[model samples]
Target: MSNETEPAPAAHGQPTLKAIADAVGVHVSTVSRALKRDPESPDASKSVRRIHRIAEQMGYRPNLMAAGLRTNRSYTIGVVMPRLTDVVIAQTCEAIEEAATAAGYQILLATPPDEVNAQLQSIQMLASRRIDGLIVSSIHLDRPDMVEEILRAGIPTIAVNRRADGKLHAVTTDDYHGGYLAGEHLVNLGHRRIGIVAGPRHASTAWDRTQGCIEAITSRGIEVDEELIVHTDFEVQGGISGAHRLLNLADPPTAIFAVNDTAAIGVAGAVRDRGLSIPRDISLVGYNDIPLVSQLPVPFTTISSPAAPMGSVALQQLLRGINEGEMSSLKLPVSLIVRASTTVPRQN
Candidate 1:
């Protein structure tokens, strides 16, 4: 017997569309069109959005895969990720799954673990399963050819949380602005000498952030010593080693900005291992204010992105591409959350 339970089986007591309808006092069919996002009924869209909120709260997904198979049109979409160990990715998927189920679609997930060959294999696997569309969360910044190959496969595809050279539609945050916000915060606190833990060379998230930080410093008529920058993987150990490199510089920075919250955790460790105190000895800033960040000893001062909404919108655009052959890129806004982790640098 296959341990794999079929999609949307209510046998496990998972909330169904009928559950949403009952909760919201609306009909199940009305909820259906609302999930599709372009409801013909004026009253239907409002009710659907409400039901969507309720379903998301209840952790409901219809598991409509069996129905798709029966109709000869698998209302299933494939999602490719680098990995889901990151809390940010996990939360974003929650939003995606809820939105997809509301729109009468099912999700098929795959992970490539950041290897190009594995990514292509996953894509092919999803294709073989006859997914109606694809939403890729990880894009190798260097590989244009891989994108072309996916496009050539004749599937409606969209990139989420990542981007390439405008060769494909991408739904992402205003990463540049996120970076600028961090830089501005640090600079406003009177830290001229700063270091950045940048991500991969090709990743727009890292590149834009690094660039935004530079722009912010330059705007204040300060020069960023290129020596303070270190490009590395978006991980905690990368933060530790990257911070080490910056702190060892002839003129170390009083402030550091990490690419993400996980890296910030490592950056904080590096500071302490070297006998430094956060904000007092050195200040820190990070991106993607995941929930766990706020609970830390010194809650991170970070840039916050709408991860779940981004996932929801990504699925909507992908389905649009599949049905209408129309596609466009989207950049959501971000905001900075000031917390205890950042403060004015001590007089040195």
Candidate 2:
């Protein structure tokens, strides 16, 4: 007597929507809506509640792959990022995943080495899987090829953390401002001879921060010693090596500014090995006020970048591009968190 046509049994003897609908004496569409309704909503009707209970009893489960075929949308966002082991990168990914879930999308993540060739392969693989969109975090500044590949895929895409060549839309913190703040803070403390643990040249984030710091220093009529700027990886070991080089100079820097907290930790280690104490032998400034830096014996004076928000906003931007066919870049604000690791230079 049911008006709804019965669907075949789901694979492996699993229950289908029609089965739940037949149990509840309603249309399959109604059952589908009931199952998708938010459980926490206060306005769920009695019939919807009854449908959920019946579906549970019938062991009904939705098949996402089947649903994708029916709707022509995978409802999946591909995320290609490097350095998942880094805490800051991990935090950003967590935010992106959380936002994607809330928006009824799943995340397919691929973490390759932060190199252009490796990333290109990862992006191609994700595109082949028919992802609805892509989110990238480790875009290199000099690689137009990567940007071209992303455009060639013809999917809605957005870059987070670092941007590539200004060709792709991105959501990033104001790295330049953050660097300027670090430099200004050091200059205010009467530290003139400053050393920089500038990260790799190919990253926009690194360049922006380094340039901002240079601007702040030069704006105050202090020349940035070309010898004082050392390019290194955004890792602790890179920090240690760079710091040691600066410390061993004929006229070593009285203050060191590391572009990231991880590198700053390395600088700290190197300083300790040299039998020098922070704010006594050399003042230090670091970017990205990561949680661990705040708890250090000499807490880092660093810039607080909005890593999580960058991920969240990047998702929103990608969604807009997908639905509206338009996207715009955004730069979030950053602030300086002064801590115990910095002080005025000692009198020579």
Candidate 3:
């Protein structure tokens, strides 16, 4: 006897339309047409449903690879963000995922290590995956080639947070308005000399917030001291260093507005290190109203960017583009939350 003991019976291959047609006692061509009946064809719903049920029972999986090769569409969206480590970015990613799932599509997320080169690589990766669309939330907006390549790939692209000067579609908050609100609020509280902790210079949000603050202060006839404005990374240490620079001035500001809450918390710590009580020696306001800001020992007065809403809107726009080639720019609203950290400057 052969050691193999007669090879086990070959497993049955997946059922095809021909096998289903034979079981249903119909022609293979009839089964094929019935399975994919045109809308104009008469009363094909029953047959189509029957075919679908049979296919399901047979554990049929569509050859999506073949279809994608033919149509050059993967029915997937590429989402590029800085990193999920940032709470706001993480929340936005969650919202995007929810929206994409609701629309019967999948999202592929990529975090670019750096602003310039990461954008280029992200675009290439999305293109390679044959993604139907892309939503990019960038730290900087200087990548012309990235946008151009996305356009060349013939995929709809939406920029989030960072806006480009060109005609690309984007979804972002009213950053200037948010900044203006923060400025006006501080000025209303009688904070005459205000300092600003700004994010990186290349980021449009940072520029908008800075300009809005300047405009608000100038409109009130208050001179915005150039030395009071310090550009730093959007991190805790950045805020700490910025606070030091501002407070060390011969005439320190009565209040400070940090670009984001993380930096604002740092400013708060710096103020305390100097044996100063918050809102007594110096009032502080922050942006982004991130969760931890409110839960801190002293709640921060801050502007709230609708991160979740922005993410949802971006996904909705991308889906529209994928389904119907629709495109539009969306600017979401932001609000200011007054908390314990800000108050009228105490007269010495």
Better of 1 and 3 by TM-score: 1
lDDT (CA) for every model shown?
0.84, 0.88, 0.80
**True-structure lDDT of candidate 2:** 0.88
lDDT of 1 at 140: 76
lDDT of 3: 0.80
Give RMSD (Å) of candidate 1 vs. truth: 7.6
What TM-score against the true fold does each predicted structure earn?
Answer: 0.83, 0.83, 0.79
Pick the lDDT winner.
Answer: 2
- What tens digits encode model 1's per-residue C-alpha lDDT throughout 1-348? 955222332345667777666766778897665555533223445565666666666676545656565556688889988768888787778778888876777899997787778999999999998898998887877888889878887889999888776989999999999999999999999999989999777677888888998899889999998898899878899899999999999889999999888888889999999999998989999999999899999999999999998998888888788767887899999999999999998996
Residue 71 shift from truth in candidate 2, angstroms: 3.7
Candidate 1: which stretches are off by over 4 Å?
1-72
Q: Which residue pairs collide in model 1, if any?
A: 7-63, 8-63
